[model samples]
Target: MKDIIILMFRLMVCIFEIWMLFGFYNNFLKNKPRKSRNNIFIILVFALIIFAINSIDNTILNLICVPVVYFVLAIVAFNGNVFKKLFGTLIGTIVILGTELIIVAVLNITSKELIESSMVNEPSAFVLTIIVKMVTFIVFEIIKQFSSKESEMMDGKTFCLYILTPLSCLGIMFSVVFCRIDFTENSLAKSVLIIFFFCMLIGNAAIFYGYNRYAKILVEKEKNRRTVMEQKMELESYKKVNVANDRYITLLHDTNHHIKTVYSLLKKDKKDDAMNMLSKLFDKYEKAEMIEYSGNTILNTILSDYKEKSSKENIECDIFVERGFNIEYVDEIDLVAMLSNLLSNSYEAAAKSDMKKIRIQMFMQNDGSFSVIKIENSYTSMIVEEDSVLKTTKQNKEFHGLGIKSVQQIAEKYNGWLSSTWSDNVFKSVLILENSMC
Candidate 1:
């Protein structure tokens, strides 16, 4: 009966360890969209396999087979590259081995004879396993809090900063754990030692929780900065449009007088002078007509501004918009920012290319449920890309890449996405928005 009870405890520990590994993988890597039943099945299968491997009582075999099983499970259940999955598996394996080693090392120091007893039927061995599993669970929970679901993209510097606290705590823990302190007959001292270890674990978790909060504040600050910049740009564009409107109103007020003067010139046989007058009038009207591309006022202004800029660079623009189409879901400032950034990128890229052409097409999908905006431009050279993101090839790299990122943020803000592709010197960008009515 005692043997059976010990077996049950060991089995429970094995299953708990396996569950922790799965939790680690899910938190460390992006998980696939799996049904709960399927997820539970995968966990059960992994638990059974790991339990069987542990039953062999061979460290080498357990290490080799256990990580292999986890690696396979990660591949099946996660959505990341092979290297990322391998890295997650490696971390799990290390935690498993490290915690078990810490447990045995500490227990042996306290009582070598108690540590030497067979692990299967010894109550002390069962307690040791429980302690190890408890520590592992705490470590796993700390990691889960550190890696957030919204943004898993931690920079190297931040990752280093995040890891420093835990490493320091672990060092202190080990120094104290390995100190020469005879606790064989001192039950109170041993209990205090265990409580101290738990305190360290709790401290590490608290530190990481603080780090996550600080990271979120940094993210919010960046967003606010971006929002302010967008508003500034929108204000500038609207000022230009307002100036053009003023000129247009003045021109309309003087229309009758201008027409009479032209007719008078024609009557006097000053045909050349009349033609010049008409030409000048036409130039003024053309400038005033620039802001008439889209039904949305903000979009029209942005398109007009970019169109004029592109024309200065001798870049041909082939823009097509479906009649009466409007972007109803996005905010005015966001529309200006997103469309302006996209066109600015296209203009810069196309201006340097031999073809010197840009194309934009906006229309609702066939089902009328989605709005599609496609932009294509010509480029002479290969585009630079980093981590699957298109990087700016300009000489000044400091402030060039945020335009694409801004567009993506706005797209995602409105249940949309931005995608870009390039093939044979023609770069393409497609933006899709849900429920953007015409």
Candidate 2:
């Protein structure tokens, strides 16, 4: 019974170690469910099962027990596909066993006599074995977290600390297992002091290495982030310039028509004709003035520019915009990109159809939380695809399905939802996004 209890305790330790390792991998190394309560329940259940089965004494049974523990851990960690879970767990088990062997070999070569002497007492030997198991677990976990394919920038300082601190603890354990120390005179005291000193050395070395590696990565990430910010700013400026230039060029071209109309009216020598011409000219000027929605200047410019293009293409564009809000929400450039891409795609599609017409509707929610956008356009050909992605026609090589992808990406970045459908020769795109201010 006593042996059984001891075995249960050891099994409990192994199960707990597995939970910690798997939890770390699931939480930090890969994307997983975020609810804390669900995670706790999963860990607890896995720990219980592994603890129950890991108590077997036979060598073959013990070997079988390892895979069982790993299998349970994989189930908890994966929570979905069995194949993926099995593959990951198998890989993890191999790595852990390999590391344990390496550490054991190093300890045997460096402190063979010390280890043998330490095992004289059953309690001391159990403690030493537990420590060895823990160190092996830590080393393997550290390797797994750091070596994954995920971008390091996404792993914050807390995760980095989790990996580094455990690795340092394992390194200290390695030194403790190997270092020679005279413990006969003051056994407990000498052992404590030696372990403390070994920890200090290992801790320092781990910190030094971790800092060197992570610091460089951090610096490079900062530089890359800065570069991205600069490029976004430049692109915004360029977009604004292009919109302004287009507006200016349209105004200049209209001036010639205005002059010719005025000259022709004056030559007719009728006061009423000149007054009518002047009234029409003022109406044209009023129509040229851009429409503003939600205080987003970029979007206003894009709407105005696209309206003019639609008129020129003989495409009937019907726009319905909600009242402008006082609050500053979504970045103007992003808004422009989103709207322009959607409208431009619609326009292009409409141009190919016999019935060239586009409908645009936009409105802000009463709660000031989100904005909704819907656009529909007439199209010539069927837009259905097996993959749910709309592909470009063969005739249009320069511009393809990239516009839709851009819209989708921008929506995703803002935690937005986008959907599209096509039927009865009409293509529709819809998007809903949280207001940036909220």
Candidate 3:
């Protein structure tokens, strides 16, 4: 009965720990549930069975089993590739086990006799273990939240002090409850080593802070570079649009002369010649410019640019945009960036595929509060993603995928959704955004 009780306590601990880990994950990564989950009930039953077996008290067996349990749960609970699920679960389990070891070290050094007595008394051990688990969980939660949101501008020296403070408190408790070390023999030496460890803890903090600062700087620089490149592309597109519209204006300016020539031919009793001349002029005018417009300048410009591009690439681009469609509240820069990216991706993929076709549809919501853009294109290349992170085929992995990522960020900023699907050798993506991203 006592063994059974211990096992039950351990099982409870496992459940709490799993729940807490996932809670932190959800908060940090903003994970959401998958739609159309038919196997959810089966997954829960498997989870129940995983947490059910704590009776096999062998360390080797338990170590092997814990990883398998979490790995399986990761597959059911997480949305990503198998490699991502297994890797995340494996690292998380190590962190948790490392924390447990830290707590054990503290307990053994501080309340050596109490822990020793607890080893013999199962109830006391269970209680002490529960207490330690809670403490460790809380500490980890604080660390994760802090690290994720830490400011790059934080002073390294002061920040390191802030982090190690809790660690120092934990160490101090161990020192005050000192029992394992022989006090008379080398108490002074042991005290110095404890101080040294505390100092080195700051070194650990420094490494984290330095890496964070470097990564933040690197990301900001990369984004700035991509933004410049995108803006330059936009400028070139606007130039082409301006040139096309100018040519159409020139054709209209010369229309009267062309019409007068046809009229003179008709007056000379050459009606067939006049009609043939008029038809030739009309052909030139149509060849010079063929256009479809949405009232929104940004949307119209990008669609026109891509339409011409599709023709050149021998890809049929079908665009169905609501007539007189206008966007008043969406940021012009953001709109341009998003549309440019979506169209560029479609054009690139469609140009490479055998089908050589791209389809785009955009419409305003009837309620006038939102809009949706849907794009589908042919894709022949395989996509490999890990943990929802897109892998690029380009030489510079850092530079590629910035377009889609920027669009995603824009969507998220507006509390909107960006969804993508690949089926039947076609890739379809949709962006739904609210008006006035205030």
Which candidate's lDDT is highest?
A: 1
Lowest summed lDDT across 10 adjacent residues in model 1 is found at 115-124
Better of 1 and 2 by TM-score: 1
Task: State each model's CA lDDT, in order.
Answer: 0.76, 0.65, 0.67
Better candidate number, 1 or 3, judged by TM-score: 1
Judge candidate 3 against the unseen true structure and give its global Cα lDDT, from 0 to 1: 0.67
Candidate 1 per-residue C-alpha lDDT over 163-248 given as tens digits, one digit per residue, 9 for 90 to 100:
67666656665454344344556655655665565565556656655765687797888788788889988998899778767978
Query: For model 3, how does the per-residue alpha-carbon lDDT over 1-438 read when each residue is reduced to its tens digit?
Result: 656755665565665566555544443343445653533443445446556655555778768887787777666666666776666676667767777787778676666575444232443344345545545554654555554543333455655655565455445434543433333355455445434443443344455447556867977897788678768866876786787788788899989899999889989999999999889888878666646667766677778778888998999889898763546567766777778888888899898899998999887775656788899999898876776866677678766878778888778767677888888779998998887632
Rate residue 79 of model 1 by lDDT: 90
TM-score of each: 0.64, 0.46, 0.59
| lDDT at position 102, candidate 2 | 73
